[model samples]
Target: MQGLARGIVVLGVMLAGVQAAHAQPIKSPQDQACRDEARARVFSTPDPQGVGPYVIGRQIYMACMQRASHRASVPHRRAAKRVKRAKRAKHR
Candidate 1:
């Protein structure tokens, strides 16, 4: 009885492996060449440089603001609320 159960389990595992193997077919030579060509084209272009000092400075300020916002504490949040209230009060 034990041997029969082991055999059934082994047969089930073998069938599952066969199904998985058939699910993905091997790529043909033409398909492989097309994939390689696509990869080469995607990586061929070089990145462009920044234009001038003003643009570079603005980018740096934005990056600093983004980092500061991400690392801000509860105190910073309260200060931001106060600033917004002050701006609204000036408009009124």
Candidate 2:
């Protein structure tokens, strides 16, 4: 029916919006501080033998961002890990 199709589309749009919202990394003040310190440390260090400073800086920045985001998601990560382990054990 037309009404049922419209309801499905509306539900899909709402779910997509929720997914997009959760996909964004929620950075805390501590995470920002950690990333800033990482940037400073990276800049202070000399570049590797063949790599350019810019490339090195980019890599450091990416790593710092990952670390900071992971720290921010610690609770979520722990819950996921626990769920995974439980599921795995149940199958065995």
Candidate 3:
């Protein structure tokens, strides 16, 4: 039982780390909008009996979330460019 518990904990930590590494921080209004839209789409589908719609729904939801977050990050890319410009200006 102890060993099982430890294994579960390890698995949970690893999963969390992977999620953190892959997750893009959503900072834009459009990203938020996309996320909201995706959330709606994910839940819109009715669960198919026996096929386990909950499980499938979760997978879809995660994909939608990723897409939404990616969309949201587009605007923030300019911030990186601005930082590079500033750095160049400082050196000049």
Candidate 4:
């Protein structure tokens, strides 16, 4: 009886977690591109047997996202130029 009750509680918690969790929509076109590429790369290969393909695809997606984040974090060229000019000129 106790085991069954614990199982029921675990099931309820799992369901609640799944219901509460949501995907963070990617805002940039670059992220969308990464997702599209990941999907294509993952789905292009036929794996009718095991979960290897899905796992590999997830790794690829993570790597792509890492790259996208790096690229997005870089400041614009105009902003960089302004900073350089400011650094060169010291106000009295």
Specify the highest-lDDT model's number.
Answer: 4
Superposition error at 53 for model 2 (Å): 1.5
Q: Would you estimate the TM-scores of all the predictions? A: 0.27, 0.37, 0.44, 0.44
**Candidate 1 pairs with clashing backbones:** none
Structure candidate 4, residue pairs in collision: none
Q: TM-score for candidate 4, please give it.
A: 0.44
Candidate 4: where are CA atoms >4 Å away? 1-28, 43-51, 77-79, 82-92
In model 1, what lDDT does residue 43 have? 38
Model 1: CA > 4 A from native: 25-92
Better of 2 and 3 by TM-score: 3
Query: Across residues 1-92, which tens digit of lDDT does each residue of candidate 1 receive?
Result: 99999999999999999889855453555444434444444334342573654345445444545555566533667778999999999999
| Worst ten in a row by lDDT for model 2 | 22-31
Q: Which of 1 and 3 is the better model by lDDT?
A: 3
Candidate 3 on 6-91: residue-level lDDT in tens?
A: 99999999999998996678877765665566566655667666456446555665676687767766777778899999999999
User: Arrange candidates by lDDT, highest first: which order?
Assistant: 4, 2, 3, 1
Off by over 4 Å in 3: 45-92
Question: Model-by-model lDDT, in order?
Answer: 0.60, 0.74, 0.73, 0.80
- In each prediction, how many residue pairs overlap at the backbone (N, C-alpha, C within less than 3 A)? 0, 0, 0, 0
